[model samples]
Target: MEKRIVTVQYNYDVAIVGSGVAGLFGACHMDPSLKVLVIAKREPDLTNTSLAQGGIAAVLDTVNDNQEDHIRDTMIAGGYENNPDAVRLLVSRGPADVRELMELGAVFDRNPDGSLNYTLEGGHCRPRIVHHKDSTGSEVQRALLAYVRTLPNVTIWEDSLVALLKKDTCFHLDVIQEHTDLIRHVNARVCLLATGGIGRVYEYTTNSKIATGDGIAFAYRLGARIKNLHYIQFHPTGFANKKDRETFLISESVRGEGGYLLNAEKKRFMQNYDPRQELAPRDVVSHFEMVETKRQNSNDLWLDISYKPADFIRQRFP
Candidate 1:
C-alpha cells in the first residue's frame, strides 16, 4: 500500500473535522464523486470512538425486540427530558445505520446459531447492544477506517488540527499541521464538525485526549446552535492511576456479563438503590457509586468480574 503524504493545502466538496466514527461515517455517506477531506488532531484511529468499549445501542432484532421499548428506555434514562422527535429519529434510523456498518465488513458478535448476538446494557430492557465482544467501538472504527481508506475521493489528514473555522459564503478552515509546523487554509462547500465528546474538560474521563470539546467550541465560536452543554456522562469504572489523567475505561459490558460493584465491605449495594440494580443507566449507576463511595469513605470501588470464567473474560476483553 502506498502511504499518502500529509499536505498543507486542499479544497474539497466536504470538509470533515475530527476523523472519529462520525466524521468517517459522514465521509462514507457522501457521493463517491464528491471530494471529501477528513482532519484529525492525531492519527485518525486515536479518536474517542476508538476508546469506546460499549456497543452502539439499536433495536436490530425486531422479532424479539421493538423500537417503542427502545424509545421508552431512552426517554426514561434521559430523565424524561429527551426530545421525542430526536429520540424517535434515532431509534428508527439506528437499525439502518447498523446495517450499513455490517455491510462494510464490521463483524458483530453472533450467537451459536449464527444470528447477531445482543447484550443488555444499563437502562435498556432488551438485549439491543450489537457488539464485537467487549470492543465494539474498536471494531466499528476499524471497519469504517477500512471502508474510508478505499474511497478515492476521501482524503485523510492525520495530526492536523483545525484552529478555526472562517465562514463568509462558505466555511474556510485554518488547520495547523503538526509535522511541518505549517498552517493552511482549506475551503469547502460543506463542513461537518464530527468531533466527539467534551469529557476531556473534566479531570477524569474515559474519552481520548483529542475529545477536548473542540467541535463544540468551534461551533459556538461560529455562532451555531448548541444544546446539552451542561449534560455529561460519567462511567463508573475508569482505570485510575496516581497521575490523575487519561483514565482507561473498564467497559460496561463487564457489568452486563455479571460483574458486580462492591465497596470496601464487599457488599453489593446497587440493589438498595434501584430495582434494576447493576444494570441501571450510566448516570444512575455513577451517582450511586459516588454516594456509596462517600458513605464508605473510600475513593475506589471494585468491579468484580472474577465470578465469570477467566477464559470468557480473556476471549471477550483481550
Candidate 2:
C-alpha cells in the first residue's frame, strides 16, 4: 500500500485552470476582493499563447476600416457558418480590448508618427493587426502575467495539474503537484477552464505541448455538449522540418506581407485553385496544398519572402 500525502482543502472565489492568454486575462479582470487561484499544468509561461506569432486583428482605425468589414471578413473566413451575433459582438468590442491590452502595458509596433502600425494577415481585407514585431501573444501574456502578479488577491501555482473536478454547492478539485506528487484539494465558487486546443493529439502540429484538450475533456465530463470536433483546420504553411514532431509555424502574416508560396517546381500553384492565391483563408490554402501535393507527387513546398528588402523584412518580422 502506498502512503498518500493530502493537503488541507483551500477555497477560492474563482479557480482558473491553465495559464494561457484566456486564463491570465480572466484573472486580470477579476475583482480584487475575490480570492483567485490560477493553476498551471506546467510553467505558466510555457503555453499555447506564448507560441502565437501573429498579431491580433481588430478594427482599430475607423477611417479605413470598420466593425462591419471586420465582421464580414470573419464570416467569410469561417465559411459563413459562424454565429452572426457572436461575430458582431467580437468585432464591435475588439478595439476596446486591444486598447485595454495597451493600457495594461502591452506595447505594439507603432508607425514613425506614433500611431499603431497595423499589418495584414490571410483572410482579412484590412491592415488591422497590431503586434509587437511578430510575437504579439508573448507580449500580451507577459503584460497580463506581470499585472496578475501585482494583485495581492490573486495566486498562481505552476506545475499543478487538476486531476479531478466535482461540483456540488461549489466546485471541488483534486490537484496533483507534478514535482512532489503531492495531492491537494481545492474548492472554488467558480471554475474557469482555459485549457487550449487539442493539437498534441495529432502526429504533427505547430501547437504547444500543453494544448492537449484537458479543458475540453473536463467540460465534456461535466455534461457539456461537445460539437464540431471535426472542424480542426490545418495550417497552410509550416516549416517542413522532419526532425521534430512539432513543426515551426510560418505565420500567415508572412503571406499577408508579400510572401509567396511555391510548389515543388519552384513555381506558384495557388492561382490554379483560388484567385486569392496565398491570401486565401487557411482552410482553403491547406486544402489546395494537399491537392497540389498529389498533383505534383511531392510535398516539397516553399514560402519565399527574400524578394523584399532586408531592412523591411527585419523591421516587420523582428
Candidate 3:
C-alpha cells in the first residue's frame, strides 16, 4: 500500500491537544486520509498515561466477568453518583478498546497457557485488569506512540502549549511553542482535548508533574461545561519519602495481589473500616487511611505485601 501524504497545509481536518491516550486514540480512530495535528505541552511520552501504574479495566473474559458487574462496581465506588450513560458507554466499549491496544502491540501479561492474565483491583468483582507488570502505562503509551508515528496522516507537535481556543467555523488555537518562543494561530475542522488530570493543585499526589489542570482550566476559560472538578482520586500507596516524595507510586495491584495495610501498631486496620478492607475502592481505602492517620496522630503508614511468597512479588512487581 502506498503511504498517505501529510502536508503542513494552512489547516488540518482535525487538531488534537495533548497527545496522551485520548489524543492518540482519537487519531487512531480517524480516517487515515484525514490530516491530524496532535499538539502536546511536552513530549507525548511525558503525559499522565505514561505515569499510570495500574492497567486498563475491561471484561475481556466474559466467562468470568460481565459489564453489568463492572458498571455496578463503578457506581458503588462513585457513591452511586456517577453518570450512568457515561459509565455504560465505558463498560460497553472497554473490552474492544483494550483489544485495539493489544492489536497495536501492547503486550499485556499472559498466563502460562497463553490466555490473558486478569488481576483483581479494588472495587472489582473479578480479575479484569489488563497490565504489563508494574509499567503498564509506559507499555501502552509506547505502543500507541509507535503506531501513531507510522500513520502518515498524523503530525505530532511536542512542547507546544495551547494558550487559547476560539469557536468559529472551525476551532482556533493560539499555541506557543516552548523551545523557539514562537506563537502561532492555527485552525482545524475539529478539536479534541485529551489532556489528563489535575494533581498539581494538591500538596501530595501520585500524578505526574504535567498533570497541572491545564486542560480543564483551558476548557473552563473557553466556556465549556466541566464536571467532577472536586473529586480527586488519590492512590492508597505512594512511595512516601522526602527525596522521591510525589514521584513514585506503589501500584494498587500490590494490595490487590495480597498486600495488607498496616498501621503504626502493626494491625490489619482496613478491615475495621470496610468489609472489603484492602480491596475496597481507592477513595474508601484512602479516606480510611486518612482517618486512621488522624486518630493515631501519625503521618506515616505501611502497606505490607510481605506475607506473599518472595518470588511471586519479584516476578509480578519487580
lDDT of 1 by residue, 1-318 (tens): 864545466678899998888999999999988999999899999988888887989988889999999999999999998999999999999999999999998999888899988887889997899888878888889999999999999999899888879888888998988867478789899999999888888877788988888888888988989997778889888777758678989989888878899988988999999999899999999999989989999977888989888898898778
Worst 10 residues of 2 by lDDT: 1-10
Q: How much is 262 displaced in model 1, in angstroms?
A: 0.3
lDDT (0-100) at residue 90 of candidate 1? Answer: 96
Q: Pick the candidate with the highest TM-score.
A: 2
- Relative to the true structure, candidate 1 reaches a TM of 0.95
> Cα lDDT for residue 221, model 3?
78
Residue lDDT tens for model 2, 209-283: 888899999999989999888899887888888988888887888998999999999999899999889998999
Residue-by-residue lDDT tens digits, candidate 3, 142-173: 99999999999999999888877887788888
Clashing pairs in 1: none
Clashing pairs in 3: none
Q: Which ten residues in a row have the lowest lDDT in candidate 3?
A: 1-10
By lDDT, the best candidate is 2
lDDT of each: 0.89, 0.90, 0.87
